[model samples]
Target: MKLFVYGTLLRGESNHHVLEGATLLFEGIKIQAKMYDTNIGYPAIELEEGSTIVGEVYEIQEYIWSSLDALEGYTGNPLTDMYSKEIVKVETNEGLIEVIVYTICDVSMKSVLIPSGNWIEYRSSLIR
Candidate 1:
């Protein structure tokens, strides 16, 4: 299964170890969605038309899905989860591909919009 990661799960970020053993399908991919900075110091992606979220896509082993789900706090119950995984089309250099993405299922409106759409850069600014 392929997964698109836009925040901490990306390479070199804190928490990136969760994706260990996964094959990196594409390091540069973008999806049409609104990116925001949550109060908890992490970035979240929300479904939005005509907006872009930059990230990477990985083809993970089937067994890794459970760990990934747990890491994202997804329990298959959308109503109470911090985030929910959904399949979305991501634009890559090869073309568009459907990949699972962990989106912010709640507190979306409360987050500050990340106009730059680059979480790594945004996160770097916060640290310095």
Candidate 2:
């Protein structure tokens, strides 16, 4: 399976150690997607665009996806309310492919600030 990542799961991040070792089908490719700033010191996908926010797409085996799902707290339990998994098209080094995008629950994103819609630069500013 393939997935699109932008925030904490990005390369060189704490979670990237696990993700980088997996198969990556896209790198440095930008596409349209919405990235929102959450209070959790990270960002989440709020909405998707037809053609704005963009990131890389990666392909990994079931085991890697399982590990990622666990790390991302993607349980389908209605009470936990982590995120909903949806397939999104992303620009890849080779081309475009539909990859999983984790859009946070509406309630969880209600309190967010919804920055300029760029997760990477927003995060860089935060760290600086």
Candidate 3:
């Protein structure tokens, strides 16, 4: 199973710790989706075409979904409520493939700057 993480799960981010034992494919790549800086807590993701944002891709065991889902607060609750976890097409140095994506939900704004789309770098910029 392949997973695409665009936010906190990106390498060097706080949440990447959850994927400690998984196989990492790459730590660079941008995905197209509407990104929002939700005033409530974290961020938000929407289905938007041609919207470029950076992230990472990984190949993991299918069984790892449950654990990953729990880390992302999925399964029991609702991914859409916290973050919309969807399968989207992403390009890695290898090629195009379907990978699981955890996108933000609810908030929408045209002015939110996604800052490189690389969550780690984006977070770094937020601090500076």
Candidate 4:
């Protein structure tokens, strides 16, 4: 399955080890979503029209789903999960393809909007 990761799961970020052995399909891919800083070391996204968010796409193994779900606080229940998986189309060099992306389940948890929509860039800005 293809997974789109935009936060700590990205290259060089914390929690990236979860994707060990996965094949990177594309990087710096943009999708229609609004990103936020949960203020908890990772970022979350919400599907929003007219918004573009940057992320990476990877071809992950079936076994990785359990780890990814656990890390995202997803328990297969929308009412309880902090994040929920959604299928969305992303433009890649080859073409447009659908990938599973984790989106914020609770809007109230979003403390600040990440205007750049790129987590890595946003984090760098904080350090500078």
Candidate 5:
């Protein structure tokens, strides 16, 4: 299964260990979504129109789904989940493919908008 990761799960990020056995199929892929700084440690995204979000695509093992879901606070219940799993179209080198993405369920957590849409770039800028 293919997963679209935009925040901590991306390469060199804090929670990347969860994808240890996964293969990176694509990087810097842009999809229509609005990314925001949660004001905690990581970032969150909302599926929105007229916005682009930069993230990576990974081919993961079936067993990894459970771990990923848990880490993202997904319980298969939209009302209770912090993030809800959704299938969205992403443009890759090959073509547009549908991949699983976890979008923020609560908009209240979103504090700042990430204009660049690239979390890594936005994060690095904060350091320097």
Candidate 6:
């Protein structure tokens, strides 16, 4: 299976260690979804027509999903998990393809939206 990572799992980020052995299929890709800044020091994404969210696609080894699931706080319960793995089509240089991505689960309407879409850029701006 494949995974689309947007935030800390990007090339050079704090949580990127979780994907150490994963093969990067696409360095940059965009998801037609809305992005938001969560209070928990991470970004969140949701399916929204025409909206774009920048991320990376990787072809990971089998059994790595459990580690990813733990990092994403997904425990098979969509009702209370912070994120849930969902299959969505992302636009890459090669073409559009269906891939599993971890999206924010049961987010509140009051969450702040990240208009820039790119988490790395958005996160850097926060420090300045």
Against the reference, the lDDT scores of all candidates come to 0.86, 0.68, 0.66, 0.94, 0.93, 0.86
lDDT of 5 by residue, 27-94 (tens): 98988999999989889999988999999999999989999999999998888888998999888889
Candidate 1 is scored at a TM of 0.92
Q: Could you tell me how far off, in angstroms, the CA of residue 91 lies in candidate 3 after the best superposition?
A: 1.9
Model 3, 1-128: lDDT tens digits are 77877766666666677777778887667677756655443445665777766667888776777777776556544535555578888787778888878765434422365644544555567789
**Candidate 4 lDDT, 10-91, residue by residue in tens:** 9999999999989999998999999999998999999998998998999999999999999999997999899999999888
Candidate 1 backbone overlaps, count? 0
Worst lDDT run of 10 residues, candidate 1, spans: 107-116
After superposing candidate 3, which stretches have Cα over 4 Å from the reference?
A: 39-41, 76-80, 108-115
TM-score of each: 0.92, 0.79, 0.76, 0.97, 0.96, 0.92
Best-matching candidate per lDDT: 4
The residue-by-residue lDDT of candidate 1 on 34-88, one tens digit each, is 8988878678888788898889999999888988888888999989998988898
Which one wins on TM-score?
Answer: 4
Model 5 worst lDDT window (10 residues):
73-82
Model 6, residue 10: C-alpha shift (Å):
0.5
Pairs of colliding residues, candidate 5:
none
- The runs of at least 3 residues in candidate 2 whose Cα sits more than 4 Å from the true structure, single-residue gaps closed, are 110-116
> Could you tell which candidate, 5 or 6, scores higher by TM-score?
5
Tens digit per residue, CA lDDT, model 6, 11-109: 989899999899999976887889888867788898788889888999988878889999998998988898888899877778888899988886773
